[model samples]
Target: MSSEAEGRFHIVDVSSLTSVHRRMPRRVTLRTDDGVRIEAVYEPSRASVTDTAVVLAHGFTGSVDRPAVRRAARAFAERGASVVTFSFRGHGGSGGLSTVGDREVLDLSAAVRWARELGHARVATVGFSMGGSVVLRHAALEAGTVDAVAAVSAPARWYYRGTAPMRRLHWVVTRPGGRLVGRYGLRTRIDRRAWDPVPLSPVEAVPLIAPVPLLIVHGDRDAYFPLDHPRSLAAAGGDAAELWLEPGMGHAENAADAELLARLGDWLVGG
Candidate 1:
């Protein structure tokens, strides 16, 4: 793995952009710190109302091309901030298998770097499910690289199998047959090995992200993680972080409605 953390873009004819193409979504490829190829899309803001760019991260089985991910990105763009949506390695057009949220921090970092390289004065990240945990860890690890971070339906701690969805998720990542299902059924490639050193959990990383404007948004009806997960993260974040418990909501990106996404965009740009 190369020590280089900044990403290099590919496939997007990033030459001089005319006003006509400036609003079109441009597809690009990114190389991560550990050297993984990622697929991404860059969408210019509708109104160009904010200098902040929003980097969006998807869920466990989600990708940059997923409807939920695209919806969030479009909504953010409509709010007047450029948006970069990327598929983590192993999902979509990216290369490599998923390490869940551990090594995925590098993935988010790459997207953030790309957003900054595009000349955005500030960058904010909003991630869902597996990606939710990645944003917290990435902000904590990269510190001031990003202006703000928001995580939705993220688990506070690791190895949580309390919920039925989580228990099934464990099966999908750990077992060989489950891995096959993850690959063939869900189009998500699973890494066969478990965490060697067991990276820091989201709650553990929350304190490190203090004063960076962290937001933890979770649903009261999340089937993957209970309210305790967000509560634990909020407690760790203390006053530095804001917690929003969405009533009657479900889980991850699919559950994130336009209203919630618009509210998220408002909070991110405001922060």
Candidate 2:
């Protein structure tokens, strides 16, 4: 990789074969509040952009190394925004089992804190699917945690099996046999435990994220959660939230295109 100065822009050429397609430059282990150690990667922004940072939370069954997550991170970094991506517990190299979205807030909190420690004055949290729900809850639970929040392909409320994909997901998350498949087949370790108090719903958490800029992105063609999901979240988010329903998109981070990701990166830093 080589760095060159061009007026106000700081250009980093990562296209060289020796440095292309490699992992991030900085990698660290963060400990969640519940004592789970998670693996996180930090991609520094271009020299011109050093004050704002974006933390990415992957969806259920996804890791920091997942292609979709990495693509999004690289997109943000390429646009001169520092990006931090981490695996929720039980997903990749992280410790502990996945409680789905229930206990994942701790994971995001740790990542956000790390970004702040890295000298970023403004931080944004962007999440997909289960991670999206987690970001809402985290923002609600930990006030002043982030300057902006973006949730993509997230369910407004939990326990809905309306779509066939959701039905299959229910089977994967609720049944013992399904969990066995998740552990072995999907390589996603789902805890055999249940939500005790059911935690907090994303719609309920939306109002609590007030005074902070919020962007809700979802595909109109998403097979997992339909339009009603983002609609409900926007309704709850009120005037502080902006919602974008894409026409031909599918699901989560995987469905995000280069242009959409660039727009999201701009939104994070108030561009």
Candidate 3:
């Protein structure tokens, strides 16, 4: 594999790394109906009444502090839109175990409601990988709740494309040598069947989000999720959705591309 491809697959410590100026994010807590409280970082827009707020959701096994998520939040904030980044349940500072994307959708729903209460008239959700699935599912479940949506490297057909690799990775990380951290919790504590992404697949949810401007961004070289997933979603949405295939870009490439940022910003501004 090429060096860039290698970097794309390797996971890094996003929370420890600092952005350009080493700025600290403003933090807050969002409480769910089930009484689960999640940690989130909020960055308000610089411009007056942008009419749109972007809620950033990280991927499975990812936290709000993940570098890509933080970068996206910062970029949206700089562009005059309120940005809220939060950890899904069992990910970072949040409580409870991860239910893959099923229960996480509730957490996202709560966050979106919180944003609405904060004077945001139109809400846009941006999610990466597993996070993408959550937002897409939310849009479908709660139609008319979100104004716009964007997802990067999100899986559409989960059973076939999603589980094989993640299951192996889970075993590797939760096994003896990597068991020092206790990140995924006991195997008995997690429902292996529930972790399947098929139940939360976005392929079935795309048609449900019709007429609600959707933007599906995926890299042509994405190793995790193939390009066809996003393309399928865009096709499902017909003219209602926009799909962008970043040339030579792999999964979660938005963190490093200005052009991707521009495309997202333009979509947000209804440009």
Candidate 4:
């Protein structure tokens, strides 16, 4: 064989590649209270019905097609659980505008209802970045409905005491120049107002989720939310919650790390 062909054959790890795609197609459109249709992809359980379901929420300016979102869906589905991933209003193929975490909470509630209607007795949520805050807040407000929650790199206090980097990012995105250009062509005026980085303040809501298992994961080197936020959240939850402070990982590592995936899977499995 040619040297290039030999190298390619050696580098390919066939064992890691699936011979066929095992994922099934799932399309759901949830109608919000305001008459907006929210787009979501549901991945049903590959194993028997465990009365458990997993919901994946994307970060700000993100869509359900994000790499992390897809990996999470596949990860949970492979574990014999159902997975649902959706785009926030004004994000991806969803309708309406982003209202930061304030209005997005309603969208999340709608998702939870959808999961319940699908016959999932126990529902857990996993969110990344801003989506993390949404899940945290939802779990707090709707404690009776959500069985558990895992938030990766979520900001605990956004309105105040947020990390400096995130504060700066908020400024940049909401600034006149940033708003005027409108990166996504989302109606600059509406987009600019929606991009405001107001904190969702999950700290206040932490106690509400007590007794309900919570998993907080944050990268020590996270530039967006910083480690303090997760620490605060875990501390607020006391012994009821688990905090995984990855030494070298940065934000959104849970979507890629096998160890992190295992931890999350175990939590969802009632370990």
Candidate 5:
């Protein structure tokens, strides 16, 4: 990184980003309410912007610095919506271990605050996969923090070990040895503790998020939670929410194409 480029990065704490790719967004460090350090990037909107800030939540083991996350930010930025992307605790350059979907609401809430601090009057969130679940919970629990929320490829209910991918995921979070694989191989840290009382499931969280607009997006071919999860979320959300069942879309941020993001961006800034 050039000296001039280095000036753009904002160091919020002693922790810093280890690397930066070509044309990285403006970086800022954040601390979650639970004292977890979070790494986030801010991408300003292009011409014809609608003055709405869109905060993106990545899936399990994903960070704001990843290529796919950056690409998705660009997609939204190109649509004239300022975007914020962040890694949940235990992921990327952030501190702490993953609580999976639980406790991630603090991280999303922190990012949303950062977006508002950047001067955007309206805010929206679009989360993918595990991230998809986080946004729903955040909107429900926080309330009035965001104008709209979208959950893509999110499971409506929790503890769903039905799918092969989910079963494997359960193993990663539930087993001691699997945590090693997550830490060493995937660069993700898993929390060993289980959900004691269990948090509100996405389906249950959906109704509470209204009259905050909600959007549920899913792929017919998703390998994770399947179509029924999205259907359940849509059903729970009722008329205040919109559902999009993409034919070819697969799962999460990696599966999301530019066109789908553009449409989502439009919907977010519409209200």
Candidate 6:
């Protein structure tokens, strides 16, 4: 634990951006409809000039301070967009237990609402893995919630336990012992209850997000969800969606490279 704390100094590498101007992020606490306290941070663009803000949602077992998320946030900031990174309930300092992707929509909704309250005219919600699925559902459930949305490495449907990683994830999500490990070892709290009526699927939610810019980014070599998931989402999105099947990429936030993140940031801000 001591060693882990020592290596946890987060470094934001935005040295490439000219006229780099970083503002210390304002930490915030938000509440979900279900009464959970969401831990969040608002990172103003290093350029300090932008009306657009991007809300970043991390993957399963990931927090706002995760290196990949931090790197992505910095990259987005360098591109001149303010960023809001938050920990979903059960992750990091957020309250409540994880519902996996079931009730996580409320968590994303809270973050999105917070971003809007920060006085940004345009807000884009960018999510990875489980967060990816949450954003899709949030967009569908809450109309006019955001201007643009990006889902990276999301699953189209639920209950998919095909890949080895996913199979292991199922063990983590469905079993009591796994929840214990999640609580103690991973610092994640898994909810003991089950989804009463499994929430809307990502494919089902895509069509409803019409007129909003939607970018579905999936890695071709992803070991968790396959190409079929993103393809289904794109099909359901009709003309409102753009799909980027990245080559050589693996999965989620950690697998997302800096180049891909920079492009995503640009797209979010309409650059």
Number of the predicted model whose lDDT against the real structure is largest: 1
TM agreement with the true structure for every prediction: 0.92, 0.90, 0.79, 0.81, 0.90, 0.90
> What TM-score does candidate 1 get on C-alpha atoms?
0.92
* Tens-digit lDDT string for candidate 2 (204-250): 99999998988999998899999999999999999999999988999
Query: How good is model 6 by TM-score?
Result: 0.90
> Which sections of candidate 4 miss by over 4 Å?
1-24, 160-168, 180-182, 185-200, 253-255
Off by over 4 Å in 6: 1-24
TM-score, candidate 3, is 0.79
How many residue pairs collide in each prediction?
Answer: 0, 0, 0, 2, 0, 1
How do the residues 1-271 of candidate 5 rate in per-residue lDDT, one tens digit apiece?
A: 0011111234464223322221235787787776677788878776464568899999998988888898988888888788889888888887777889898899899889877766678999999999999999999999899999999999998888988999998888889888899989898888788887799998999999989988999999899988899999999999998899999889898998888988887887785
lDDT of each: 0.85, 0.84, 0.69, 0.70, 0.83, 0.84
Worst 10-residue lDDT window, candidate 2: 1-10
Quick one: RMSD of model 1? 3.5
Worst 10 residues of 1 by lDDT: 1-10
Measured by TM-score, the strongest candidate is 1
- Candidate 6, residue 120: the lDDT equals 74
Backbone clash tally (model 3): 0
- Rank list by TM-score: 1, 5, 6, 2, 4, 3
Mind giving the per-residue lDDT tens digits that candidate 1 earns over 181-208?
A: 9999999887887888899899999999
Over 4 Å off, model 5: 1-25
The residue ranges of model 2 lying beyond 4 angstroms of the native Cα positions read 1-24
